[model samples]
Target: MIPPLLSRTILATTLSVIFALPAAAHFQEIIPSADVLPEGGDVTLDLVFTHPFEGGPTMAMKRPVEVGILANGTKTNLTDKLVEQSDKGAVTWRVSYNLPEPGAAIFYVTPQPYWEPAENKYIVHYAKVIVDSFASGEGWDEMVGLPVEIQPLTRPTGLWTGNLFSGVVTKAGKPVPFAEIEVEYVNDSGIKAPNDAYITQVLKADVNGTFNYVMPASGWWGFAALVEGDKPMKSPDGKEVPVEEGALIWIHTSPMGK
Candidate 1:
């Protein structure tokens, strides 16, 4: 019923608006089979680069540049232990680690630079997660000395669903004032977001580079503090592109059962 010229114009506008909408935030996930090892045994870790909230279209991750675990004041390199995993043609990584002692094992990964054509930039997320072994409650705050990292103000593990998680966004061991952090939950329960806005929660750090968020659900929550890299990197097409450095940390929360 509409004029052909006007109809074409409207269709073009609609398509443009849809494409203009921001894509779901990319989270570098370092999920473990268990966050706490009450008895202290082997723990399996899955490393994937994906949109945790939307839950799919996982990006292919090359073998990490570095992977290690810090425990009992010692850092052990585990890069050679990584085994490649594939899902629907996307490459991921997995590692199995044994926790024989009682302490917090902080595992971290420095992934290869990923090129994002949509943003015309490269992404490098330094991600880490803690596995408390035997509930020792010790060494939970040890710094991995990553170039960019989230220094937890609160203990990073064994939390209730409604507990508050707070941390400081630091780059090169110094606070980054008012840093932007993106939070997302790993969608294991098939929960749906009512709108696109709910897919990723955004918050800014305080003047001291501290941020707080109370997770409403019980699952693995990831907080990524995004900051521009100090230097540019060569893109796949040989262009000099800026890098988006994300200091990411993941924590698990359990539901308070009746």
Candidate 2:
């Protein structure tokens, strides 16, 4: 006969495997060193896949399918300049761009499809961030022509912490009705969540596909609008699964002076 304690341990391990879950929100982050620049110069960016609120257990990122910056009415390709960085057995990416002249730099990345065994599907998050240079205040409304993207109703930069952010979720150039958006604040390395569900807040767009969220804290915040793709992708085990298409946008807000 087996000891009761040994029996309990086996049961717990079996349950854990049976219902494996993702610990935090999976965000494809294209974060820059600074969101606003007083003067124009060079800026560095890090492309990572991780739970921003938890800081990370960084997920591996393959070379992105497309990467560029839309500025001065032109899109400049920066894929060749990407540098891969590895941490704790996971890989990420980095790049540096010369922010010449005064204007808005909208950097975007279309990451290669990432397969999640837990969800049993592939995820492709089209992520972007805006940097205001020299307070140029131009091109904040620029669009990247991605398959899925967010059109910011409010100016994407120079925002206050409590200001409301609103944007439309569009796929293939048409607005989606009642889209689902997931929100998360970049945890700045040490913010603790009260519970598992608290790590990622969920919201929905209105009938016109426009969504709003009030900035709750001062720092970088990411909004991801997820939808299903028309096509399905094959999994490693040879099963065809639906593809998750996400349109993600990032913005930074400042707190009032103390």
**Where is model 2 poorest over a 10-residue stretch in terms of lDDT?**
17-26
Question: Model 2 TM-score?
Answer: 0.91
| Candidate 2 residue pairs in backbone clash | none
1-258 per-residue lDDT for model 1 (tens digits): 999999999999999998879776998999999999999999999999999988877999999999999999999999999999996689999999999999999999999999999899999999999999998888999999999999999898899999999999999999999999999999998898898889999999999999999999999999999999999999888999999999999999999983
Highest TM-score model number: 1
Clashes of each: 0, 0
